[model samples]
Target: MDPLHYRAFTTPSGGGNPAGVVLDASGMTDARMQEIAADLGYSETAFLDPGDGGHFRIRYFSPLAEVDFCGHATVASAVALADRDGAEGHYVFHANVGPIPVEVHSTERGYAATLRSVVPSVAPLDALAELLRVLGWERGDLAPDLPVGVAFAGLSHPVLWAASRARLADLAYDFAAMKDLMIAQGWGTVSLLHRASPDLIHARNAFAVGGVVEDPATGAAAAALGGFLRAHGLLPADGRFTVMQGEDMGQPCRIEVDASGDGGVRVSGTAAPIPVA
Candidate 1:
């Protein structure tokens, strides 16, 4: 089947993160899925096998590896299903990360999806020096209050808060070495952020482990960040925030995070079809 392409977390003024969605991936082998994902070369691709109505078995792959979950791909896949089947669709997905509940609805921005993540956890980073060495960042460059931690919603992400927007924008690190470190640390992406306000944030992600330079809009990382914030007392249990990413990449994306309602963190985004060229 042909892959469906969509850019998730799009704003009217800016493009968003692109992902490939295979609505009918039943009976496909792991090798076949990896080949397809490598061919598509999107940051991530979602493959689904339909189960009961609104239920599916989903899998995520980067060019190089299969992952537990992918937030942007989930958003894109949800919208793709809605486009094919109809709006106000409720979906239950069983990915490698476990079960995820997603609901798609039409919004003023466009077709949007909300995915409530599994209960998350945050842990202190033990290899801070090695991490800094890989990122080429210094102790003084970090926000004193934010510190650093590894957060997990579905996958693990090392969260770093820059003291200023300037610091965040000047992101340059040893890619090959960073990839090695990320692999050793069992991390998906490194969530680098600068808090613009209590509810607004500027962000970037280094996804070396996924064989990518950066992720334009990382939904999974956004969810994990919300968990980290609430755990650290930076955000209330029911707080809401927006993460602005992909600005430097020219694919500006907006992600809404709700660390509210029960113990799960909810990540929401709008997805639009990517026209074939």
Candidate 2:
């Protein structure tokens, strides 16, 4: 199957996280999928097979291994489908985690997709000291207000809020150690963040566990962060916020997260087609 290239959380001209989307992967084997993902060299690639009643069976694979779920790739796949089909409807995706609903709409800029995550959760992180050491961060560097925890939307991420934006910007970390720790701990990413305002936040997700140094924009992590904020009473019961990521990488991704209901945060962003060779 020929893969459709799409960049999720992007601007008009294309600065976002690129992903490979195989919309009709009916008979593809797991080994082939892994090979394709590795060959593409994106953070992740999505393989989709049409399921009953407009639902799709989706699988996400990184260069190294298959992940339970991936938000940016999901967004990219949905938007690509919408471009091929039509926008203004919801697409059901059956993932390794659970059933996820992605709503697509034709916005002024382009096709935008919003995915409602599986029941989000937050819990205390166990090895905080070792995790911090891997990141070259100390306890003092953490934002005392936002407690360190493991947050899960579909995949688990260690949510660490930095005390200062500069600290977040300076994101030099030991990739090998972090990858080892993440594999052992079953963490998908280490989401380092800095809140600039009540409604705006800056984020950097280290994704060494997935054989990638970093993710430009992570919708799964964004949803998990929203859930963590609401669970800890850091934000209002109904809250909407923007996360700006990839600024340091010069790609510039924007993700909008809305935690309006009791469970499952909604993550939204626009996607653009990447020029394929």
Candidate achieving the largest TM-score: 1
lDDT of 2 by residue, 1-277 (tens): 8888899998655689999999999999999999999999999999999987769999999999999899999999999988887656689999999999999998888899999999999888998999999999989999987788999999899989999999998988899999999999999888999988878999999999889899999988999999998888777535999999999999999999998777789999999898877
* C-alpha positional error of residue 178 in candidate 2 after TM-score superposition, expressed in Å: 0.7
Task: Check candidate 1 and list the clashing pairs.
Answer: none
User: Best lDDT goes to which candidate?
Assistant: 1
- Candidate 2 has its poorest 10 consecutive residues by lDDT at 229-238
- lDDT tens readout by residue for model 1, 94-200: 98888999999998877999999988999999978999999999999999977699999998999889999999999899999999998898998999999998899
lDDT (C-alpha, whole model) for all candidates: 0.92, 0.91
TM-score of each prediction: 0.98, 0.97
Residue ranges of candidate 2 with Cα displaced over 4 Å: none
Decoy 2 TM-score against native: 0.97
